[model samples]
Target chain A: MSGTDDNAIVAARNFVASLPHCRALGMVVEAAGDGVATLSMPYSEALIGDPGTGVIHGGAISALMDTSGGVAVLSHSTGAAMTATMDLRIDYMRAAEPGGRITARAHCRHVTRSVAFVRAEAFDEMPGSGPVAVANGAFALERATDP
Target chain B: MKRPEPIQVVKQRRDAALRALMNGVPYIRFLGIAFDRRGDELTGVLHYDEKLIGNPGLPALHGGATAAFLEVTATMTLCWATLWDDLEAGRIDVATLSASQPTRLPKTIDFTVDYLRSGLPRDAYARARVNRSGRRYASVHVEGWQDNRDRLFAQATGHFLMPPRA
Candidate 1:
């Protein structure tokens, strides 16, 4: 890989590492590129909603998508700036397969002066397979100012 | 302000039924949400638990936990309201509801959450209202707040699948 691309990946990873919520949820940055990012969360018994079903709770899926959306926003960011989600909508298509790692990929579809729009989807085991949940979000971006 | 005597009497029974159902759900227990009844409405509380912290930098509550708390609250509110309606109509007896699970648990079809402010670490509160409910579907809106109700940390709207009442 080119040095510039490698540096961008490192920067992206470092940025995610700085968020406590991402770390607490066991979310890992798989890969990131201009306006796109992928994150994965491993299966854990503690995250199950229905012990009878053993499927991960919908809340866990929501957090994964929200985090993925933020990372995607960062990929397209021009400089270091603070970002927070203004709103997020999640549509649960199906339950995640039991005992499988779930991955979410988000793309920053567009950015306005005050907001960044993102779309994300979560899948189990494979990225190309059917998605377990899909989400669209808008994030408020505050650009850093020069001192 | 005081409610009418007949309404008050019915609410007492309904609130007790809802509390019992809330305690039976495993996920509700896991989240440690407590229900409070105000007339015909319900409010849920999520007390501070270190394990629920998602944003340690802000020392904030986990966004997922907040969403789950609201989702469960909305479901429970609909269940309670439906049961009250059935009881008033003499379609189901209070004994039947208290003795067994409700006809069915509400399933979420879609959920949308709006983050207005960072959820600070503390006992968070949420209240839900069923905008519309039918035999096959229900729509609910919920708001999460801390300290001041006027300032919400997050608000969510969701559509849930409601099974036909037996």
Candidate 2:
């Protein structure tokens, strides 16, 4: 697929917009370029599990990585890709600040007949110094056949 | 505004949903996932408490628990989608399992996690999204954020294969 395929990016954005939680969290695709896609999700209080003390849950971060990496592959594949995370390892760099926007940039490093590899990084744009999280992902793409 | 209902009632409903969602998973019960039914969407939350601390030094939440939360959220989304009368619920039963069926059962083939932000003392919030294509399988995106700060603490994306039940 061409890097400037507006149709593919629009389809991906539409799919994400249809999700309730993604809407609640304010997730949006900022841009798509050359085999790379950038997504942003805002923080919401309803997303917090512990109200007393502020702590962003780990599960939320995983979602961002998945979306970023999946979209990265989708940009290059002709058919839809079904990502099966073979393995995932995370290193906590630091705690996120309250009410900050987390932005992720994902790039496809390699793609073969069935497997695709991607790397992503997410960080707060308010300060935007060091990254809050970095991820490397592998996904399997299933080519769709014409009926 | 007044609190909705008794916490017990809410807890019971969440437990039932979790049990129906997956089989042979003991940690879902142990973690105490609470479900909120809003129209068609089923929202589940794993409340943070003192017991959630896995390591003393960094006090990171257990990775397994985080993974379970992601898997369950995806399963719940597929389950909720099954309620539509026009859709075949049975296919979904297999699909949901396939969506999360790890390449290696009870073992992670590959996992990449990022810590976007950290929480202060206790508690965090996690949100997940599951995307399914036709009836084959699904992909889930989960994010964990420190409760107070809107910044994400960790994020993960997972893929599961759904094959017809044998």
Candidate 3:
């Protein structure tokens, strides 16, 4: 990508980071390049649906997948766009325990005129292992119009 | 062994069962899935808390989370309606359903949510209009309402492929 394209991608990431929920979720853009972005969300007690058992909610995991996937496409397109999830399927390979940070690596597999396909995986960092939940997502992006 | 109950008997009972058959999902219970039920037309609310927030500027519910909820909701509706009786009976798992499916289930799917209007800062209300075709496939129009006002947070339509009974 040209320097201009790279700068546009950075600007897009900054814009998404400015969203309120992104900040609340503690989402960070770890890396962005080649139409892919890796985002991370720190595990917190607030994410615990079952306090006693300390199990992370599926909703929380899904949230991470959606944001990371959306941002990945946004960074790739380098345009102001609103994302709508056409379909998302999540397979819970294993339980995501509370207090364990989950990171999502999202990549834009394909981008059509109006639709973008993305896949992401959420993993907890342990001694030496990979992610837990693998999520596949598709997002439809419409060019944003400024008022 | 005692004679098994008639299929009709099981179907009748299923119509009134509220609990999700899938077990060990902590968040499903936390979200109060017990209060919800599936019908010819399934309607339910997806409760959201602070944890759902992803971006501070939007403070909006994450889109992928919304999609997963919709897929599960639609799947449960089909299960509750006993639409997949053949699959449940171990007749066929992939054939019959795949032939006549409504929503397409890619390994991964995308959802488009439009924030029609913003609602209360905390909770959002969502509903789905489910439609099924003669034991084949099902389609749903789901909407999320938030901020007292009816802002369309997310809308989804999904298809599940059921295998045929042997």
Candidate 4:
């Protein structure tokens, strides 16, 4: 990795770790560059929504997607120092298998003056099963003010 | 002839059943969100905890946590509604639900969250309204607020696939 890539990765790590909830959920940024980001969270007992089924909660998956989407916007070429989720629509395709890491990849599709559009997908590493959930989101960008 | 159930008895039974249902979900327990039951309505409270902060710069509640809070509220509301008939008929009660774990909450089909405002670092409350529910499908809308009911920080609409009746 080049110096700039190292800096971006560091920034992404800091950006992700800053959120306590993300830390609590054990999210790690696997890669980031050019308006894209990939993050993963390990399966843990605390995230289980149903005690009997032992399946992870949809909320945890959404949280991972939401954070990853926001990070994607921040990593865009015209990077903004800050961004917030304006709206997000998430579809649950299926439940993730227990004891597997869930990974989410987000792409920053478009960026205008004040808003950036992003799409994200969360899936288990298991091949052929496809995504566990997919999301389309719009995020607000914050630019620096004039001196 | 059997006398009809008194109002206090009904309220107690409902509260107990809801409590058991809430406790059954490990995620809800992890988030420390508790439900407050009113007559036919349930309010979800995401109790403020330092670990919930998303943007430490602003020290605000994580948007994801807020989303989860709203989703949990909507889901429990749907579950309660589904079990209402059984509750009224006295076929289901707190003891039976806790013992058997018979009630299976509906599976979420899709959910849309509109972030109205940044969630402040404090306790948040949410209530859900069922838009449509039938034999196999249910749609619900939920709103979350902190200090005042009129001012909302977030809202969501979710579609759920109801489980088969036992």
- Report the number of the highest-TM-score candidate: 4
Show model 3 residue runs off by greater than 4 Å.
A1-13, A50-52, A77-80, A144-147, B1-61, B64-166
Number of the candidate with higher TM-score, 1 or 4 = 4
Best by DockQ: 4
lDDT by residue for model 3 (B54-116), tens: 444455555644554554555455554554454346553343333333222111122233333
Residues B1-166, candidate 4, lDDT per residue (tens digit)? 9997898898889988887888778899889899887777789999999888888998788888988999999999999988888888888757888777635889999999999999999999999999999999999999999999999999999999998888
RMSD of each: 4.3, 18.7, 9.8, 1.5
Give lDDT: candidate 4, residue B33.
96
lDDT-based ranking? 4, 1, 3, 2
Q: Which pairs of residues collide in candidate 4?
A: none
> What docking tier does model 1 reach?
acceptable
lDDT of each: 0.78, 0.55, 0.57, 0.90
Runs in model 4 deviating more than 4 A are: B1-8
Q: Recovered native contacts in candidate 4, as a fraction?
A: 0.82
lDDT of 1 by residue, B1-166 (tens): 9554586677766765675666556667666789887666788888777767665666777666777888878888887787776665667665666566534667688999988888888899999989999989999999999999999999999998886656
Which has the greatest lDDT?
Answer: 4
lDDT string, candidate 1, A57-138, tens digits: 7877888888788777877745436567788898988778989999999999988877888999999985566999999989
DockQ, Cα level, model 2: 0.06
lDDT of 3 by residue, A5-121 (tens): 667557657865676556766777776666677788887765554333565655667777877787777777546366656666665565565677788888889888778888888
For residues A92-138, what per-residue lDDT tens digits would candidate 2 score against the true structure?
Answer: 35556767777888888988777777788878765747877677766
Q: For each prediction, how big is the interface RMSD?
A: 3.2, 14.3, 9.1, 1.1
Model 4: interface root-mean-square deviation in Å: 1.1
